[model samples]
Target: MEAFTRLDAKIAPLPLANIDTDQIIPKQFLKGVDRKGLARGLFYDFRFDEQGREVPDFVLNRPEYKGAGVLVAGDNFGCGSSREHAPWALMDFGIRCVISTSFADIFYNNCFQNGLLPVVLKAEEIQQLMDEARGGNHVASIDLAAQTVTSPSGAVFHFDIDPTRKDKMLRGLDAIGETLQAKNDIDLYEMKRALSQPWLEEA
Candidate 1:
């Protein structure tokens, strides 16, 4: 996972509520476990038409929103099945942060694990950011260390995040990376256990 310290990039406005994981990366695209190539399938249904052409009206397809790194979405974002692929797809598509009024618990946790920042804000604040995202600039600034999101209009909104998760994201530490932080201790414990029970190691 990549470290997420700060981001100042275009914002894609997705104002629809109850956006589930399936709508994020459709099940058919879940053919592989690798995170690569998932970007092509991100928001597949909404980004493409029946004939597989790009949907002109979609926020992501619009020229102004191209290369957007922050997504301002409606309430209940990332709902439904707990597919880790959702965050993978989002990050692969260059979305480093997702701002919404609310998010599903599983999806929220998945975001942190994958180094994607899931930001929760008041309904009015979300609406304001969404409006700014759809405006001329379509850009927002996010500082993970400061726990702040600054909209295009220069309005700064503070968000709350767990300290442990915050530190992990800052250091680019996933579950495996976190565990590896105690490598010396783990190695020493294994060595001591092996010496105490040589037969167990042989088995």
Candidate 2:
């Protein structure tokens, strides 16, 4: 996972509540475990029409929102099935942060694990960011270290994040990366166990 220190990029407004995992990537596109190419399937239904043409009105397809790295969304974002692919798809599409008033529990946790920042702010704050995202600039700034999000209009909003999760994201440490941090201790323990029970190692 890539470390998320700060981001100053375009913000795409997705002012819809109760966005489920299926709507995010769709079941048809969940054909592989690999994270690559998942960007093509992110918001597949909303981004493309029945004939597979790009939806002109969609925020992501709009020229101004192209290359957006932050998503200002409505409440109850990422609801429904506990699919890790949702965050993968979002990150693959270049969205590193999602700002909403509320988010599903599973999806919120998944975001941290995948190095995607899920920011929860007051309803009015979210609305403010949403409005700014819709403006011509469509850009925002986020500082993970400072736990702050700055809207395009220069309004700053502070958010709360768990300290452990914050540290992990800053260091780009996923679960495996975190465990590997104690590699020497783990190796020493294994060596001691093997010496104490040689037969166990042979088995």
Candidate 3:
């Protein structure tokens, strides 16, 4: 996973609540396990019509919000069944940060692991950002180091994250990367264990 220290980019306003994983990347696109090529399928149902033409009104489909890196969405974002692909699709689509009042527990955890910042702010704060996002070309500046999100309207909001997850994100550490951080300790433990429990080893 890439390290996400800061982001200053246009915000895509998605004001609908209870957006589940299926709505994010429809099940039809779930065949491939790889993260690549998921961007085309990101919000597939929402972004395309039955004939596969792009929907002009969707926030992501609008020309003004193209290349948006931040998303200001409605409450209970990422609700429904737990699926890691949702965050994968968001990241593949260049969304580095998502600002919402609340998020599903599983999806929120998935974001950190995939290097997507799931920011939890008060409802009023989110509304303020959402409004700013609606205005054309308004950028949202986020600093993970400071845990702050600065909206285009000049309002600042602070957020909290788990210290461990924060550290992992700052260092670009995925599960494997995290384990590598303790390589020395793990090596020593393994060596000691082999000597102390030799009989447990396979012949």
What local distance difference test score does each model get? 0.94, 0.93, 0.91
Task: Give the candidate order by descending lDDT.
Answer: 1, 2, 3
lDDT of 2 by residue, 128-184 (tens): 888888777787899999999999999999999999999999999999999999999
- On a 0 to 1 TM-score scale, where does candidate 1 land against the true structure? 0.98
Error of 3 at 187 (Å): 2.1
Clashes of 2: 0
- List model 3 lDDT by residue over 1-203, tens digit each: 79989999999889888999999888888898899989999999889999999999999999989999998888899998898999999999999999888999999999998899999999999888888788754788999999999998878999999999998999899898888989999999989989999887756
**Runs with alpha carbons beyond 4 Å of true place in candidate 2:** none
Model 3 whole-model lDDT (C-alpha atoms): 0.91
Taking the tens digit of each residue's C-alpha lDDT, what string does model 1 give over 37-117?
Answer: 999999999999999999999999999999999999988999999999999999999999999999999999999999899
Which regions of candidate 3 are displaced past 4 Å? 194-203
Error of 3 at 111 (Å): 0.8
Clashes of 3: 0
